[model samples]
Target: MYQKITVQTKTEVKPQTTAHLAQTMTLLNMGNGEVEEEIQKNLAENPALELDEINRCAMCGSEIAFGVLCKNCMNNQLKQDSQYLTFVSTREFPVSEEAADNEDYFEDGTVDRQTLPEYVLRQVGMELDDREKMVAASILTQLDDDGFVDVDILELASYHHIPISSVERVKGLIQHADPVGVGSKDAREALLVQVDELKRSKDIPEWTEKVISDHFHALLKKQFSEIAQQCEITINQVEKIANFITENLNPYPARSNWGDVRNPQENEMLQLGAPDIILSFFENNPQKPIMIEVFQPANSNLTLNASYHAALKTVDKETKMKMREDLEKASLFIKCLQQRTNTILRMAQVLVEIQEKYIREGDRYLKPITRAEIAKKLSVHESTISRAVSSKTIQLPNRKVYPLSVFFDRSLQIRTEIKEIVEKEKEPLNDQEIVTKLEKKGMHIARRTVAKYRDMEGILPAYQRKEKVKTK
Candidate 1:
């Protein structure tokens, strides 16, 4: 008499895929020491996995010690720059033999340094209620070392099971923190924040924010006239605002001072073992192929236990099943390691291409590169580039140890370039003249940029410099 309807639902099961992804993310964020520790743990847990003696080089991919370039690659490199690319393990922790024997670690564990996020949270806590504190904490965890908002406000709200408006509200409030541009997602946003702060104190020119917000790229590219026309302002006004930004605002933050990136006690980067990837460039080659090498420590050399595999055939069904599962887990772990190597290699290859000038010439030539640019070029997410470079270091031919973040540093490098130009000049070059010289060298800097950099150097203007020279 009564009709009923049947309802059906399908549940998707992807345990293997999900587990692979979870492990991959874990490996991606791991530093060299952590990876070695993980490999040791895997060997201990998985009966089918065995540690092997690594006979081949992880660097330069040859049959030799992986710490330095093999003889064959070394000779090839010598023919070009005559500089052998060497990668060595650096101690990330300050521990003596006695400290090592004792359970007590380095002072880094108990250091008191106010990280940017911690500083921000305390400020937010002073103003916000209990509910807002929760949202602010979530936001704090996602910030990069330079104090930029690393996640989308909407996505964060959705993920945290909070309203979108709540996230946006806190984001706006956080952007007003002391650094002026601390919570920005990118350069324009940071500059805009600075501009806004200035506007609140004094009436900035109406077109100032417009030029900074819209034509920042053009500004970076040194298209001053274009920015002037677009903003419907005079070139002189553009020069004034440009000078203001250079003088009054920070274009980039020193990440080392940021609490999250540095050791809380030392306020420096973590020292780690051999670089994950070593890049040896063929300076002579027109295409400039770089040899990307992975450092293979003894602990990281993992292989399948052949003895265990052979024993599988003679075991009972339950034991054989268990062996197969362990084998699968070991294989999954190995695959994650292989993928990690490939991802690191690709990231290093991109770095070599982008920082070729820095590698071939000196630190002066290191361009203003960003993870976004690298991600765009590599067709990966920006987060991937960030994770790949987070705790890594690249050893250059000059025998200098530089963190991967050095490639992304623009302001300090540009200041160095300006100082070099002034030192090399026969006479004191005026700010306008310095700008021209920098333009010729592909810097495209504004005249205000020269004045700002010179002032930071505590060097006088052209007239003052000339007067001092005459007296000398």
Candidate 2:
């Protein structure tokens, strides 16, 4: 008989190229100013890297200054009347000293229109009736930053004139919304909800829920040996379950609620600076083709130092090795920078193509799109698209600066609809009446959501509006 031997093998996964990773780290996620700062930092550190005296436009190869397109190519682009033209420029609007000093005013969560309560309400509101919605709203609005319910259920029930069971039911519904555990009473409750959600779709370890529910304190303290003793499982099994929980679940659900995208507060601040991209109509007419400009920090070309290369041959082996390393680093940086520009140009073209009407018109015309959809069109990872758009502002043809993320805000169209509906209301309509109107217009949303959107627009409720109208 042939001898049977059991062999173990290690599987090696190939990693991304250094150049690709460098590109991603250096330029893919950086804003215009941040990219400029990175390039300047590299230039200062690397003797082998130098800025080209004769800067050229990447498109037409015409000589230009640092960070911008040649004037001739720009004129030709406009004269051609292309549907949309993407060019690189460094021109920026000057921000006031007061604005610079008060950057915190923009970055702080105060101006964020998409509050967590509003976001959670959008998710859970549709399943609730008026009373349940009020309860849900009360619970959601009172949540701490971690998305845990901060208020007492008994007090809330008393205030709303509802049974404690009704409040409990509403809280249960809220807990099951996206992010899975949001609105839970505490971290333990949040983790339990997440485990329940995981169990629905996939087979988790049999002891996962038990450990989370019964031995949660031990788990939190990482007393794996004690948990193993109590649960009668091996320490290794308990460790694996711990690893699974760490990988899959979050105790603070609100922190990761939006996925890879920036939270609403960050989105609000992103629009404060000079726009990274500008869309303008040809010859100042909306009927004409749109000119799209993607801004770069520098107009000059980043190039390798020829003198540094020449001196490398004359140096000792030690110095020559260092010089060669510098040359490689410089070349990689240049390539990555170019890749960044190309990626943004391609993305800008796609955006203009899909959202041309919205660019020419207003928020009412915004076509709903997701980063994933754009990434699919561009044959890139969704996170790549997210990084490209993050912290970048875009100026529309109407001279208003908004975050590039505004292109993907799915709620904009509905919010616009609500504004229009409210604007044209014959009498001040209640949220349910507004919902019926929206249903007729092929838009469906919950009444509470209608209330939230109306609140976002600073519109008064039906009774308040009626009272104001009577006063008028």
Candidate 3:
């Protein structure tokens, strides 16, 4: 068993250059943007690379060197497109009964809505004498979106150099404000304040009101039978009382009424075009006939001068070696830049072919796609796919295009078949209706799940889509 054994093998491997090693190290260290910056820097230093210009319109057969579109052709295209659709003014219209009702409600002053601080100040102003307005204002300012003051009354009093009793009195005043239940130091107090308001309005019976005011924890935990036994009321009565309490309570009472309305300054138009990469997609065969015109170093006017070479020949050995090293580095950098551009172009072409449906049909047709899928198709790593897509955009026939990254989204619970059913329905389907329809179609789904998918698609809730009939 202990007999001697010998194994012989021969292998050959190519030695990597210092420049190649340096490039590997650089690529490992830098991100996509940094790599792009490095490439541009190399191109500038080399004086060898040049980005080719697209001189003709692919569509109209016209010369358009400086820009992608010819002036005459662009104008004609715009004119033809303009005839298909008309732009509308942003004037207010009575589009829905609910909207009309909302208009009438505001006109009749039925709903008393106020800004957070204003509402707080009104109640505090009423309760507090002129002496404590500053303390009340300070307390109101400290209250957060949930209407709960983060700082303790004593802490606020210490900061303001006011008596703790004054802080408490001001807090009580804010707690009694309209949109009932604001400036409470805690959730318990907020809920109690709301229950008290409901009690005053006689929204619930005396026994049910007591249960809500006292045993809020039991109600929250859905301990309806226990609450009913304690309050000597039916389970049904407890449920009704709980609903009334929920309806009355303002979870974020100190939050401004105008919270739903966005400020115009916040609105921004997302520009979706990459001017750097000149891409052209051929209409007939998009799969194989796409062109990515990258900068070619050979096209540049740079050449090794005869005088410089003659001078170098007469120079010292050290000087000649230095010049050679610089030339080699410059040449290597230009090569690396070209390689990077080629990689990006290859990735883009693959993406266009795979996601052609999204480009042709629009956003509604966008399916659940991923970088992994593209990487597999392109014979590259997932990281490479991510790098290729990052900060890169494509120009399409319809408009200036965005990165292919924008097209890929997570798949919704609503399958393609379910979506088709919803779309083909004569009437708009609410979450519940959609859920019911899905169940009939043998797709097991909950109402909440349906609602979530609708939300993901940016579709509104059933109540929002409901329309009123016109009556004479």
Say which candidate scores most in lDDT: 2
| Candidate 2 C-alpha lDDT tens digits along 1-472 | 0011111111232465755663654477667766877888899999998887765666666666654455876677668765676676654445545555654434221122354556767887887778777677656644554677655789768756789998888888788887789988798999999988888898897699899999998897789999999999999999999999989998877756454233343333333556778888767988777887877765326778999999987999999999999999888787677667767777888888898888877788889887778878877756567567765678888877786777887778888999998899889999999999999988888786787678757789999999999999
For every candidate in turn, the CA RMSD to the true structure comes to: 11.7, 18.1, 20.2
Lowest summed lDDT across 10 adjacent residues in model 3 is found at: 1-10
Deviating ranges (above 4 Å) for candidate 3: 1-40, 43-270, 275-314, 363-367, 410-428, 435-450, 467-472
Using all chains and alpha carbons, the TM-scores for the candidates as numbered come to: 0.57, 0.62, 0.40
- Residue 359 accuracy (lDDT) in model 1: 76
Local error of candidate 3 at 181, Å?
Answer: 32
Which of the two candidates, 1 or 3, achieves a greater lDDT against the reference? Answer: 1
The lDDT of each candidate is 0.64, 0.73, 0.50
Which runs of model 2 end up more than 4 angstroms from their true locations? 1-16, 65-69, 75-81, 92-271, 470-472
* Model 1 Cα lDDT, one tens digit per residue, 229-303: 887888999888888877777754423234343443231323322345555555545345555454433455566
* lDDT (10s digit) by residue, model 3, range 1-472: 0011111011132454656633533342232335556656755664333333423332243444442334544465356642111111111212234433443233211122233554557655866665477566555544443566644677657645678888777777667776567777666677777667766766554565477567867876789999888878899988887776666564456432433221222211122212223344443344533333322122221233334455667879998887676666655654444334445545555555665565555554566667677767666545445445544444444545444345454343244545676668666677777877878866777675676566545566655554521121
Q: What is candidate 2's TM-score against the reference?
A: 0.62
Q: List the residue pairs that clash in candidate 1.
A: 89-274, 92-271
The whole-model C-alpha lDDT of candidate 1 against the native structure comes to: 0.64
